[model samples]
Target: MSSTAPDQPSPARTPQARAGHALADAVREVEHHVAAAGWDAPVRVFALVRTQAALAAEPGLADQLTPDVLAAARADDWHLTSVEQEGLPAAEDLEQLLAALSWPDAVDGVAVTVERVVLPPEAEEALPADPAEALEQLLTHPQRQDVRLAVGVLRTGATWCALRTRAHDADDAVAQGADLVPGLVAAVRATLD
Candidate 1:
């Protein structure tokens, strides 16, 4: 007898699939942590490291993590630990900021979350060409929408993104996919290279 019905596919069992799931989970966790801090926050970056290795390097860290986190870390050798990058130097734009970032070999993956004012396509036509004026227009435009984009990428090239709009602030309303923000994914992926 077949182990699984033909119509019902089996769950992802490959190493890459597992890594993808782990990376997505890590990205969502980071996004939720940032969301809890409220909106209008600065661009936040985090390095994803293997929890098992982290624990092996510093056994005292186990005391800092919650029971759930510790349990999960113990259960999965590939579990990731998010280490926030603080004291980041100021940069003019997301592109500039990401361009200046580089991770050590120890880092398994990286994530970045940032808020942006999104304007409808029609409203974009009326905005001034100057960067500062355009931002001012976007900030005050009646049709403007605020969105927080969280993107994560592993060294193996797996990518996942989460987008939360200010209008739909609920956790369940957050959107998740591998290509939600391709530009951001590419930028974050570049840092891992």
Candidate 2:
């Protein structure tokens, strides 16, 4: 008698895997909403969401803002106003801002992921000498592997925003993400009004 081999077991799904899937689904939902609303500016929305994630990673960074960064982020001007107003800085607002910035582009949706390195106090001094080296050290740290740095922004004339980062990941993304929202919101709101 011939017998077939037993079936192999499937690999277990980790929490990160599950979370990523959920996030992707959420992005899809946001896309549906934007499409239905027919809002122009898809790149703006994606950029705003990315900016939100960046600011959330580095809160209070804006307080230390300079003209150079501002010029680089002129496309995301709303962040400047939000920084000035001390707004709650919603991801949705970023989406609206994106729409405003990229008017007539028709933003259907946006999803993004970012990875960052946090500089330690000891490393701060080295930043001026060789910033890239410091960043490499932080990124390669054994303790930093599991960290997740991300920001999700959804908009349909109205916007919704959420900021999150993994524990192993440095709090940099959180602060950065927070700092970026104000300028992003201000820039977008200006166009809407």
Candidate 3:
């Protein structure tokens, strides 16, 4: 029942692909954690650091995390631990906030979770010109959909995105892919560089 050629291994079996898969797993984990806090949350940011490095830097962290966490860190060389950045300065928009960020060498990647009100293409055409009026219109648009978008990007260029619509709010309902939100992914990736 296997369609893959026996001599030539599947691309998923390659190390790069494997690392991308692991990054996706980490991104999903962070998304689920944020989702648990419910909707209407402020834009939250996280720094992705190698768990092994975190453990090496602060051995006391070992006592705080569960045994499973410790084991996971030990199992994967590239296992990442997401540390939330709190008390961030207010910015005009997500892009503005992200534009001001630059990670230290210790950080391996960055992730951001934000909620946005989206309107269908048809509804967008009739929106008001004023910024405030447009925002109010988008909020009240009949075809509006509230969405929580979580994007993560690694220094190595691996990226993953998770999108959960408020209408279909559930862990299983989240859509996960490498480029679900390309624009946001690019914004996050820019911080790494």
Q: For every model shown, what is its TM-score relative to the native structure?
A: 0.90, 0.28, 0.90
Best by lDDT: 1
Worst 10 residues of 2 by lDDT: 77-86
Error of 2 at 6 (Å): 66
The sequence of per-residue lDDT tens digits that candidate 1 reaches over residues 30-131 is: 999999999999999999998989999999999899999999988877788899999886899889989999989999999999998888888998899998
Candidate 3 collision pairs = none
Tell how far residue 47 is off in model 1, in angstroms: 0.4
Residue 142's lDDT within candidate 1 is 88
* Ranking of predictions according to lDDT: 1, 3, 2
Model 1: per-residue Cα lDDT at residue 104: 90
| lDDT for 103 (candidate 2) | 23
Instruction: Give one digit per residue, the lDDT tens place, for model 2 in 1-193.
Output: 3253346322323433333333344443333433334322223233333323345667665566576654544443222212111222344544443453432222222343323345456655545457677567666765443222223433433333333334522222333232244444345544433
The runs of at least 3 residues in candidate 3 whose Cα sits more than 4 Å from the true structure, single-residue gaps closed, are 1-15
Please give the lDDT score at residue 169 for candidate 2: 26
Q: Write the per-residue lDDT of candidate 3 for residues 52-72, one digit (tens) a residue.
A: 899999999899888998898
Which lDDT values do the candidates have, in the order given? 0.91, 0.38, 0.89
